[model samples]
Target: MAATEATKAADDAYDVIVLGAGPTGENLADRAHAAGLSAVIVESELVGGECSYWACIPSKALLRPVTARSEARRVPGLSDAADVALDSSAVLAHRDAFAAYWKDDGQVRWLDSVGIDLVRGQARLAGPRRVVVDGGRVLSARHAVAVCTGSRAVLPNIPGLAQARPWTSRDATSAKKVPGRLVVVGGGVVGVEMATAWRALGASVTLLVRGDGLLPRMEPFAGHLVAESLAEAGVFLRTGVEVREVRREAPGGPVTVVLDSPPGPGGPGGTPSDEIIADELLIATGRAPRTEDLGLETVGLTPGSWLDVDDSCRVKGVTGGWLYGVGDVNHRALLTHQGKYQARIAGAAIAARARGVPILESDRWGAHTATADTLAVPQVVFSDPEAASVGLTAAAAERTGHRIRVVDQDLAAVAGASLYADGYRGRARMVVDLDREVLLGATFVGPGVGELLHSATVAVAGEVPIERLWHAVPAFPTISEVWLRLLEAYRG
Candidate 1:
């Protein structure tokens, strides 16, 4: 237990103290300092956090080679050069380079340049605005403390799983050598993207999905298209299956798994597969917030639970608004970009409060509010034929009681898409508010669709009316022309 504030004096004090030096925390401290507040950031691991070292950076670095080579093959003149199989060793080396070789020196220097103090130790809330680091050093916050600890990947429950030594997102992204045979469990972005990347890198990959399709949360067709592409690329794709047991007799040897009977309509429960051997096993089922040991309990907030926050990213239920929750810890939006957006808003709010300046805007998304997270959040799954979506889905819009008109466009039919790839295959959808005549959401699944997401995000967030959208002409012979096609379909 930390000494009471009356007993021990603070070793150091700052106007703003941030926990976790991930992108979210970094942004928060930067914003706070820019507001003329002294700031210090605490981090126990690499300063860049998951997105920089594991989840987003290395994963995308691993996928980009596969995507570029795949696109090269689609072009007529480049097919011969791209026909050759990818060299796994080279790909792994490239991923290592992009992940900064798992070092945080560069990031630390960045913090120094930005004038934010860096403290290397695990931080925990003692009480109110006091924090204890490494169970000894004390830091005091004059105004606010932001928790940007982020989240970690979760492993599912299964018999003998502990002894089996499975890989998580970190292992999958930072793997030194490609396994000869890799088995992936789960069907979400991490599962599918890693499966695609490893399979392209010469691993005999098998994807086991408990659900009937992949990318279950998106439009049904997104899963169908990615599944088809995975199957065509030699990944043994299976759905409606669950892992029963995992067994690895010798450490560092091959892994063997047992599968339960298919849970489809035809097979309720009957048999179990005895042996499915693989070089490695990755469980990418889900993620849980990293608030488990942040001393949230000291502040009357439950440990190992997501922190509830208002639009300004300030924790609710606390007597005062001195505690803020940013990034994955808040559970507002899990995407790193969304977390960074929230940090900027929370930082400004903290600064205004410190100066006794009233926060004027509450819901208008002014300098102090994070309205975009709820209104125009964007995400991109860097799997083959990237799946990018912004704002609400068609189902979400309907559920929210918004009367909407749905627009669909076959991306392959778009002239620009046809010119981009010989056998271009993809789809685009937009959900428009019937009364407002503005976009509520948009989804695109195809090669190079990720580049088109910003426009959709701008349209959805800006709430540009349909009439104004018609005049925003798309450039000729570009995949962006699908915007015009979508507009035409909506009008008809």
Candidate 2:
């Protein structure tokens, strides 16, 4: 049902219209269609969106081989074989394959197979329940219109940064040739992941952090362990430093990055430090929601601002509940998986409302509510020592006025962890709501801990009591046994 030239010229309508055909948008369309709604989705670029080509898939493809090699090196008998350099050409080719060679044909086919219409153009709200494509093609929605346009990487306003053509998350993940020297600005997920990827690919990476350490939002020790692993991997980390200026003589020339260093205790004001010259520079500072040019002004909504939404993903301040915002545009959880979760909830809500079904239970874990976004949003960072967390950290729980107890466990004490790799080092923490006797949050830092995050997510989201969690025994001789150890620590 792609919009051919004939279909593009004619006025089109559907029961539900979705803007931005990313994973979020795709799921929304699919769910709506499943619920007996005629759905159409519009996109300005590839249908699979950012995660399919730039952010997640390609990035993970680049990291898997590096992680495998690192794991092999950690084993007692495989160190020598794993010491060989990575095949850059093969790695880049594999990444391209995972990115689907920058093609959207498969996605378009999926949409067609699902009986959803696809319009190949940028779309925006022309009025309530009305959407206008780039060439003035009008689309009217009978039930709802969902906005899933995601975010883009934000480059800092440093002088000459734009002109220098620095790489954003997209460029770094899709880069074919690894630079000799790479300067990574920021210590967030993108910064750390890209720094790790390029460093493993034989680049001399210098990571500059404006804050005290990496992953400032997670538990303190998660950042500490990640910083230790990055340092051990030979990445030169410079904390408490900000980029003041960027200069590049030509398009393909070397980049010069100037740094501003704040003075220490009992010292004077900030001073400019040594300039860093690099073959390329990457700005992984942050991301801004892509709501700037969506014709929000026509609907009396401010452009360039994140759309506020209710528990059902319905945009606030919009009349009639016809307009909905999901994914990054709504400023909920920004992870792709969370966005998909929101999409499912939003799509189900739209379907239920269309059928005049009463949605009574919209609270935590309800069928039509996005409750997990607040209490149990899980995230995994694919660094050398992977960092995974869900719900409130201990500090976050305390700040929210919760009477909580914290339990910490040394992962090295677990026999399964010791068997996984030689000299394994890791830690796990569980934050419990003391009054409720339920899990509030959990954080795990170490190799192969990403898979264990779901257990914590279920505990927090399900509000499972600690006494009951003890009965949910873990199998022995597996890293999952850390859960049992954590329970014992909490009891002691």
Candidate 3:
């Protein structure tokens, strides 16, 4: 859908103007409309945003088939049938279908149905409650203007890297053809997940990690288990290695990656330090908040810096509280789901403030408070032997000075898990706050553990006590029975 000019006059104003039409921006607009506010959302790209076209949806679509076949191979009778290789073309087609072929017609209709005006253009903060779209249109906001521009993938400054045209998370997820030899740099979520997807799609994957292991933010055991699984799946893992340079002669040519010496203790002395040529190189280093060119300087804020927000998602500085930031721009948990949660809270707060609600109650778990951003953030990486976690890890809890009891359980010991797979290998950990007597965090690593994470998320967010969790029993002959075993281990 092309950017259509609004029929309203040039001086027309809305109660709220949300920048960026990503999921966070869309949710903010919807919530503000629900609160009876005349809202408008400005977007420079597709209405459904990154998760819709590039990151989450397409990547997961590619992964689901691989995961299903792996699960089938683990079962007794299905093993023989599942041994057949995946059809890469079919998988890519399915992924394109899930991404809607990068079209936003459905999302545009959604915005129109909800009565929110969609302005398609790059938007910049002009002044207090003012936004200027790139096409020389000035949008005036009567109540608030939200920044939900989200983030972009950042590649390390390796020599010739930019010229090499290395694939970012976007290209990796949306590639039309899988490369024969894929060298994936960085061992983060995108790196591991993409490597898993492409490798399963018949790419010979070599994963390079600068750190000692993958998933450094997760529990140590989580990375250990995932690394083991990747190795078993024939992904070559190279730890403590850095890509020092990159060179590609032409657009469709192979890429040559140069490596630096491995650092830190126990580094391999004989490891080669140069020249890894591959059909494609994926640089999934990290992401930077998309705040560089929003013209924040027009409002006495720094450009290219993350916007700090209170629980209400209001930008910390710039008096009068007319400016707000949510999602990746605010740097409060960069996951898509968490951004939507913040958008809901921010929208409610915006509505209350617009109505002259004298006191905004932003207490813990309040309607206008984003308590979960700090307390309980749930994430699931859909790799083989999936890693699903919520809240803090045991290390994070201990570092924060919380006296906690850690419980460990082998998922293989669960009767349902053994029956589910011929040789199920996984682990579960629960961190209990001694003083609060509630779950501080939980980590589950294994096949089919992604769905089980919501139970932990609910327990942590609700602050459910240990005693109360006893009555919430898991059904027999299901992988969820691991919860009962975990609780038993904690009790013992």
Candidate 4:
């Protein structure tokens, strides 16, 4: 639709006004529509958000081939596959197809089919329930205004860095041709996964981290194992180093990086010189909420900051309780799935409030509250050796003063693991609450472990007793048999 036509259409009032059309906003609108409420989602960018085009979908498409080859190489019968390199062009093409060639027509059609309105422009709060888009279009909400703008990558301030045309997470996942020499900065999921993907595509990838470990958020052993696999896959793994300056003399040429630490054996990045040159540089340091410029000040909230919300995702301290902060903007759980979950709770709560229905805020498992965001958030890092974790780590549980006992299991010892691959290597750790005999947390580090995460998520979220879990028998031979080993280890 043209800008004028869109503005004219949005002039009318809606029951739910969603700012940002990511998965969170989309789900929120869907839920509102299901409750017979009119919804309009305003977006400044593509309708499907970052997960559709960049972070989750495209990154996984690029990574799936790398993992498939790695999985093939581990099987003894596929010796020829072990020597074969990935077809980088085909991999890139697959990523493009998954990302829908960066188009939002399908998403727009879906919204239309569901009777949800989409406004294409920047949206900001005018006051209570009023929103103003970029082209001076005014929109009013009767019940709620949900901010689901999600987040953006943070780039650290370094000399000549911004001018150097560095790649952020978006560029890393969507690059046309892989750079011959790629340097990834940050130890988080983005850094490691992209490092794994580009290196497998034949780039001489160098991963730099100021911290000592690759995955600082996960268990220590998870980092150790992934770092080992990355190094073995020919990624120059450098830890305890910082980039002081970046120099790119000519445009689209090699970029030189100078580290703060003194050069060691073969220099800082395993090169002869103290400086590391790369065709492209990626900064995956962190993410910041997109609420910075959404005109929060008009609604008595600080601009450029996280939106604080309650269990039901309603913005706290807002006078009318018509404001909601869903997804990354609220900083509850930054994962996409978690954000969508918040949207559901917030949507139902908003609808109930609109109907003057009582909200069961105190009930932890009520329909209008998002309790799992606090306790059982699950995460999966799609590296060569995948790492999946739900709930707390042992250290986190201990720090939180939970009476916990840690049970460890070797996944290779499971009969299914041997059948899956030759000499499969993996580990599983479950934090058991001694007082309740329920799982507090679970972490799995190995190949093909992502599939096992939801079971752990359910166990932690439901707080199912260990004895009850034991009754949930496993099939004869599968990686899932590791659950039996973990139980036996805990019992012994």
Q: TM-score for every candidate vs. truth? A: 0.95, 0.97, 0.97, 0.96
lDDT tens per residue, model 1, 184-247: 9999999999999999999999898888899987877888989998999999887888898999
lDDT of each: 0.89, 0.91, 0.90, 0.91
User: What shift in Å separates residue 444 of candidate 3 from its native position after superposition?
Assistant: 0.3
Judged by TM-score relative to the true structure, which candidate is superior, 1 or 3?
3
lDDT of candidate 1 at residue 20, scale 0 to 100: 93
Worst 10 residues of 3 by lDDT: 1-10
Candidate 3 wrong stretches, greater than 4 Å: 1-7, 263-272, 358-362
- Tens digit of lDDT per residue, candidate 2, span 215-299? 9989999999999999999999989887889999989999999887765521123344668899999999989899998888888
For residues 375-447, write the lDDT of model 4, one tens digit per residue. 8999999998999999989999999999999998888898988988886889999999999999999999889
TM-score between candidate 4 and the true structure = 0.96
- Per-residue lDDT value at 439 in model 4: 97
The residue pairs found clashing in candidate 3 are none
Candidate 3 accuracy as TM-score = 0.97
Clashes of each: 0, 0, 0, 1
